[model samples]
Target: MPFQHPKETGYGHVIERYVTRKDSDHPRYLELGSRRVLRPGWPHAERFTRHLIDDAAAITDVELEALLAYEWRSRLTAAWLIGVDQRTSFRERIGDLLLASEVCYSGGGYCFALARLGTHADAEILTAYLDRYLPRTDLRYDQPEALGALLRLDAHLGTQHADRFTEPDGLWDQWVQALAHLQDSPDYTPAEQRRWTDLHCDFASGWARP
Candidate 1:
């Protein structure tokens, strides 16, 4: 099924108000959330992660949900906020967004959130996403991250839920075969062992440090 129009997916007034803010009212967290991944070695990456995490923590659940309804930038930051806080209450909704795959760039955040939640339910969601999207070789949306998250959950839960996907002639194998140029490229890494490291990891590290 195709996605609903962006105009129809979100609360227009709410998203407009949130996205059009000035200075302090603006959601700086959205802009800062990806800095860690984009500039991993910069001295300020950790600080940016900490600052965004703090900002995310300050957002209300209603506000966060509204952000999730908006475009990729807002959805990405909202997912990070929800994940960092381990708000399992939003897990189903986040899972829906992951399966929706409505837009690019935000799916990794959804995968991150589900992985942080780390429940059988979350694994199911990631599995469902892979089950649906992995076979579609034309679409490159978050397959790596979703698979990474599912494997992470399997590791944490002591289960083999990811085996079906990793096995020979599996969806993953088919997906790799579709990547014609990248098939034997030395630079290509399989999603099974790939780590979708992003802002959440940096925030966790910043908090864990004494």
Candidate 2:
């Protein structure tokens, strides 16, 4: 959607107004509740999220739900927005948002959002979900993308379930290929490789340390 400031003032009002804006030829505008405002493009997503952080108090449960329900592509945008909002206090609040549902638009966006938030106390909660929900044959194409997000988060947050990736299945190859493409350059961190090694010991172990 084309960028347009809300006619109304205040972060909440601005988000609310944006939500109500009629869909145009561009991507749809999403009103994620009183505190959250989402535009179609990644740039606009960043801008809108910055606006929300400026007025964090306005964030509400309704907006969180809207974010969770967001489609996968949009969820990635939402993830970026949330990552920018990283705050210790927001951990509990964001965890509450994820608690509402498990079946969401699973994509790179959703993965990042969950991973970013997973760095907080909420990480424990999501770790459980990740342990239980991950490694499925379904979403095989998307598994690498999801695993990349999880590995990054595990690296940052130190998840106990890091070893889950080390399974002998082709998951490691998938992870290597996925990480190579998902990131700008094919570089893996020690922590990142730890998760990879846990999944594919031979492949990760053989690689020289970066």
Candidate 3:
């Protein structure tokens, strides 16, 4: 059989456990894929990218299922997880740290492994996260890697993708386009992982539009 769209598979139903935040007895679900990432003893966790790869693999054969299957955290985690999982380089591996960042917020991490793989283009995965879910108020997600990925993109591409951080304009359409040097990129303010700077709130609230 072919790889079915999630809508067609049994595992898709299992994945829907995360998607709908629902649970079942026979369908084998993590029920907490994102939460499982937070455990102190998560295997291979010393390596953030690998851990995400493992976590995502544990969920489904097709990584995109994890992308499609859930609460935004699992989805965002899936973004980083799949990004690193897909990298074909091994020379990039280094010591473990807070990529490890999303759930824990412990900070103090070395380089982002995905970025190290020279996959600045992979920011598209996280871009999907922002584009897909940022407008809603129901789900909560964490993306320490997102901020790191943006910086890595800046370094790699000589572009300054907007900051959903200290500046309201980083995520603004103008800079995201300038950074990609494309006619367009996903343009909007994301509420996740922000510390509520007045400028950030202004962008989110539409009080400060550019």
Candidate 4:
């Protein structure tokens, strides 16, 4: 089947389908992620997030865990948008389903979501993703999204680049340090955060360039 961006939301909002592909090589094992997101410019974005948050709050602990594990990447940022710090299994469930989720399997665009919930295992997953979906060859080079996310996570965790993900030239180390500085500081304002996110979205969208 041709890959389609269905306009379904957690609620009943109708979104225009995102750009679709005709003969995509979708992963056979695609697992679902957080259903919090709506169409990119949907008018009901806030309502969608609120609905999911309320739905999450009313569910049993089991359901909440599923909600958190459902990060369509960004660790499913909306959950935290409403402050899931006190929600059941917030940390425990985040990224727990990576091995089973098809988010990264789809392509580099989805892999971009890894940074929000970045972990050691996710780093490994991206490494493998690059190898499989964007691998390098003497005559072929793939522009992988793995770099940006890896750099951001290294900063978030305040750590040097992991050896497995590192290239021999130490470029990853310098890049990670620079990205860490750009991270939201104690004084970073909400407006600044929005700008940063907008910039990120631009860069991420460009990753679609072939």
Top-scoring candidate (lDDT): 1
Clashing pairs in 1: none
What does candidate 1's lDDT look like per residue over 1-75, in tens digits?
343323564544434443333233235445434443455565554555565556556667877776776678778
TM-score of the candidate numbered 1? 0.77
Candidate 4 clash figure, as a count = 2
RMSD of each: 4.6, 11.7, 14.5, 13.0
**For model 4, how does the per-residue alpha-carbon lDDT over 25-44 read when each residue is reduced to its tens digit?**
22111111222232366454
List runs of model 1 lying over 4 Å from the truth.
1-40, 186-193, 197-210
Per-residue C-alpha lDDT of model 2 across residues 120-173, encoded as one tens digit per residue: 454464554444434442432334334554565566676644455545443444
lDDT of 3 by residue, 1-210 (tens): 122345554445434433333223221123223334344565633343232334434554454443334333434333333333443332122111222223332111112333434454444444444444333333333233344444555556676453453264433333333434323422223332222222222221232112
* Candidate 2 vs. true structure, TM-score: 0.43
Q: Lowest summed-lDDT stretch of 10 residues in model 4? A: 14-23
Estimate TM-scores for all models. 0.77, 0.43, 0.33, 0.34
Off by over 4 Å in 3: 1-8, 12-63, 66-69, 87-148, 161-210
lDDT of each: 0.69, 0.41, 0.36, 0.35
Better of 3 and 4 by TM-score: 4
The TM-score leader among the candidates is 1
State the number of backbone clashes in model 1.
0
* lDDT for position 10 in model 1: 50
Clashing pairs in 3: 98-101, 162-170, 162-171, 163-170
For candidate 2, which ten residues in a row score worst on lDDT? Answer: 200-209
